[model samples]
Target: MDQNFSIVSLVLGASTVVQFVLALLMAVSLASWTVIFRKYFAIKSARLKTNDFEQEFWSGTSLNDLYQAAINSARQGSPLQRIFASGMREFLKLRERHLDSTTLVDGSRRAMRAAFQREMDAIEANLSFLASVASVSPYVGLFGTVWGIMHAFVGLSNLQQVTLATVAPGIAEALVATAIGLFAAIPAVIAYNFFARDIDRLSIRFDSFTEEFSNILQRQVAPHPGQGAAAPSAGPSTRPMGAH
Candidate 1:
């Protein structure tokens, strides 16, 4: 048989339900691939940007200068930058008020936590859909295959004798549903898993940066040599936000 009368013809000639199932699977597979490509780039970019920011942060540059740059790039800053900006901004505001070290730390922590949640939410967008496609696509394809086989056997009941030629086309068409289902599911599953792992690592990095920033502030909060003897007086909290 020519190529046109093979699987292509089988699919084209499939029952209405089987054809619908195949069409649905193809659509899902296409959509899943789109998400896979998009998410691959997005998560990778986020990780790379986070690494670059972390390097810049610990390079002993002045905090105020970094904070200023962060503010300027606020629109395009990575998750790390956003979290730092939120904490540092709150720290600066509280310090200007002459709040005690403990209160300053608390406010800064709150600010960073809020910012962290927002960034994480952005990173996690659409992951659930990928997961859904991965988990459900196979079953959907199996449903199509089963329906196709039933359809073939239904036709067989009308024949006087079953032959390979009579049975092959129906089974072949039925199997296409499963093939398309696997095609849709496998990439989605792989991409979803890859993103989950990468995102998790990024999450850990964000957490570590937050804690380290808080510690730097905590050090500034402590009294200087012999200053503990006198009452604590605050003036911009020793410039952790401005890191002289």
Candidate 2:
């Protein structure tokens, strides 16, 4: 069993550096797989939650009611819910201070923008590492292969029994490192591209939602006569006689 499992037999006469390279490739592959699975679930859950929240939001629900619901279900929080809460809270704060419509909209927009950036940051975490692994692993593997080939030639120079059979095994073993590197890299590259596209789509959705919500608030603050504006409109008929 030991003879069958010797380095020369198992690795086809690979050098120590070549074996190390293969091990490194395997480790990177395992790490990338773990990240892929984790991000897969995370993105899926985020998308589902975002979709659910958007449905509830556009169903004529009250903003305060939706915010309360989101707070109550914080464990299932979505980016859209968080952004809505931030914007609404800011708008309410400005309303409480008796600020004008422009100020209120500005404050709420700022809050929503901040919330959007925060949510994006959370969604994009660890993606850079995955991307780096994808882009660099192949080159790393090729370096290992070059080193292995150099070592093989050096070994042949010292040995008098060099032949086609003797050199072929070492070269084959070195090529294995490159193959393993590519195996680790390809899926990581594909997954990174997929996740990046999904993130961009989500970002666009968030931006559009922010704009729509802002428009809703603007209309609310500037309602027609007898409508429920936060503050009464100033007019000769509606204002007190002594008012400025």
The lDDT per prediction is: 0.84, 0.81
Q: Please give each candidate's TM-score.
A: 0.90, 0.87
| Local distance difference test, candidate 1 | 0.84
| Model 2 vs. true fold: TM | 0.87
Q: Model 2 over residues 2-81: C-alpha lDDT tens digits? A: 46345457465577877888888889999999999999899888899999988777665667678678777765689889
Model 1 Cα lDDT, one tens digit per residue, 36-109? 88888888888888888877777666677778889999768788998999998999898888878888888998
**In each prediction, how many residue pairs overlap at the backbone (N, C-alpha, C within less than 3 A)?**
0, 0
Q: Pick the candidate with the highest TM-score.
A: 1
Give the lowest summed-lDDT range of ten residues in model 1: 229-238
The prediction achieving the highest lDDT against the true structure is 1
Give the Cα error of residue 25 in candidate 2, in Å. 1.7
